[model samples]
Target: MSSESSQLHIFFLPMLAHGHMLPMLDMANLVASRGVMATIVTTPLNVPLVSRTTSTPTSTKINILTIKFPAAEVGLPEECEILDSDNSKDTMPLFIKAVGMLQEQLEQLLSAYNPDCLVADTFFTWATDSAAKFNIPRLVFHSTGFFCLCASTCVGLYEPHRKVSSDSEPFVIPSLPGEIKLTRMLLPDLPKTDAEAAYIAKIVKTVNETEERSYGVVVKSFYELEKDYADYYRKVFGRKAWHIGPLSLCNRNSIEEKLQRGKASSIAENYCLEWLDSKKPASVVYVCFGSLTKFSDSQLREIAWGLEVSGQQFIWVVKKHENNAGEKEEWLPDGFEKRIEGRGLIIRGWAPQVLILDHEAVGGFVTHCGWNSTLEGVSAGVSLVTWPVAYEQIYTEKLVTDVLQIGVSVGVKKCDGLLGGSIKREAIEKAVNMIMVAGEAEEMRSRAKTFAKMAKEAVKEGGSSYSDLSALIQELSVRRLHH
Candidate 1:
């Protein structure tokens, strides 16, 4: 941003989910730090969640404006403001319907505030129409990278995956800038039943309609990370978009901010850091599937066995489950914790992921390949053991393992419907060894470090993402002037 204060007021509307909300807050913080007035529009219940994560100090003010989530109208409990992986399948339709119902309240807010621009999550398809009614530009916010967007566009346009005889057959996503091959299983599963299929079709239709009508997309990626796909998306796919991220970098300065980026950390920051400090440099493997994924007890056991057998120092973050019937012990082998006492740390809830990844003791990551995690790991320069569990994650896995060659796959060939299928101990152990200790580890780490440098540079002054953000603000400011 330039020295001059921006004459712009931007309203941000993120979906009621962790992955979507965190990045949007990061973007808000970034813009506010650059002298642009920002307001986050969210539901009542989400306010606390947002406030907790965005506690970092900033010079310029950022406001939080809440619209009551219509739980009664949507047939949900009043406290059901956020959705997660475990309950998403059952609750998504109701969740989306409730989001749709917020259109009027949002329009009312827009009319009263009259912000220059509205940057909203892709889930709010009606934002296009809402922004148009107020004659303001609405920039759609996508949490994924350019590669995933381009791949999705190609898949939708060409449907090449349909030509394959089996789910495992690799078919190229036609007309992309690079050769991106994926099996049908790697994509989001086809709607299983007719009602589910109809719901998906409705969402697809709305998303397509809104995207065409919106101003452009705001992607959480740096141009250098996926330059070819970024170009292809604009030129060939003809979508207007800007890459203004690795958004997580905004919280790079403070350990408090990093640890509290999404939810409150279950473990203390100093304890985690001190544990990392005890290890040898580049010797510990960090294993975390994203927030949304929940593995069965059997699957969890496999991971435990794999990490134990790998004989490597590791920190594993497990999703917190309310123990109605003692589920924790079901997943662990007898005396497992005692056996790995000195070498392993298991966090039962949120861990400060960025802080851990940035540590010198951490050399490798075992990730589910969600875009945020992928970019964070890349920025931290850690080689990965890719274990893609859900939609578009496999694409990211391919980017890391195939295109970028900075990671190795855990040989997970299929997605067994979101909660995730189990990978055997042997495959997990092998991938951990390959990325952390084996012959390929050095080369992978070097490549990852190169990308890490590029990521940091891209977010600094005069860099690609910085320039794009500046241009976006200038454009929006000019439009405000005209109005």
Candidate 2:
């Protein structure tokens, strides 16, 4: 390792959301551990969140730098956040606007540190331009898997998604190497209002421009998981994209432990982890819907009864905000908690998701199929019962369930807005039974376990992900010398 090839300093600017921020932070830790100087650019409000997951990086060459969030100025509450599940729909525009205001401070820091490369989130579409001003290489760290990336790109380019008559009308995307069929509903949301339409247009334009200016793209994925899509990203897109992931593997236990300690899970508080200890290995279902996915009261009751009917030992995490308008009692089925007292543990607020997923007692997951959760489950060797709640989650579910054949689809087709329609007990019980029960679901479990091994190996010294990460660092270092 020559000094010139390994001495690169990389600056990372992750988007404000937990899904985006946490993975990027894990990436920063990975980059730092790989012998590069990695600095994370964030707002003050989130600094504590990051700090808890990590120590003041002495062994790992990582640093967290913060800027003030203009919450009050932007008519947001003093505690405005990007990833907080409780955030209202109306605050999205304001959150974006507030984060955009950081560009000036970002520019100042870039000048001060003079890093070799600027690795930024996709949301900060202006970051590429800022890196250009400093004559630095801009590498976009997209917090998405390669499968989702390819699917989204193909759908956008082909526009076949628009030809569908309704949300359920599945159509094959006109021109893609892989077979991906999606409906209009699964496609990215089209603008409903004039202002929204304008914002959407501007975002599209900025993202396209950013892509053109980027030196390369870095993703939170591993080569083994989606080899075809990774190949397509490089050969078809004509871009340098590295898949260095199962990102949670970077000190997974430490981060998960810190997060678990930060908040006491509701009612059954510290009981979820302890309860898992009492169950048999690969015997419990860990049910969580990521940070988002607000289920309606009817949907909540359905899940309760479904879990009861499945007769599987489980740990179900329900967020506090899910109880609104003093309707907590009305949400669950009568005596749902009392009936499953010993069999099921209901955690109200945040739980250490990665921790629970990794537990020996956890055999299956009931998930919304968010990229992070998907990877966590994959890494943990846990079979999934997919119930995609929002965003490009349906696309993720397809990748996990259909393409990889490692999970069972619960067939939740329509997206759930805030308090949307119910996912009936039948759907829940069917999927859960498929994953938890024997005979028919063994293949799914075996495939998941196989992929989980690959996920762990991918981050080891000689793995594909390791090689890609090393190449990225070396490339940045060489560019530093030229600069």
For this target, which candidate reaches the highest TM-score against the unseen true structure? Answer: 1
Q: Rate the local accuracy (lDDT) of all candidates.
A: 0.88, 0.79
- For model 2, residues 290-346, the per-residue Cα lDDT tens digits are 775667667888889999999988888886465566565676787789999899988
Minimal lDDT window, size 10, model 2? 255-264
lDDT of 1 by residue, 1-483 (tens): 444344578999999988889899999989988878889999887888788766686425679999989978878877888887556668777988898989999999999998999999998999999999999899999979988888877787788977999988989888886687788877876677999978877878789789978999999999988898899888886888889999999888877778768877898889999999999999999999887888888899999999999999999988857567745578888889999998999998787899999999999999999999999999999999999887778788878988889999998878775577879999999999999879979999999999999999999999999999999988888887888
TM-score of each: 0.96, 0.92
Span of ten consecutive residues with least summed lDDT in model 1: 1-10
Off by over 4 Å in 2: 1-6, 56-61, 193-199, 253-270, 322-328, 418-421
In TM-score terms, candidate 2 sits at: 0.92
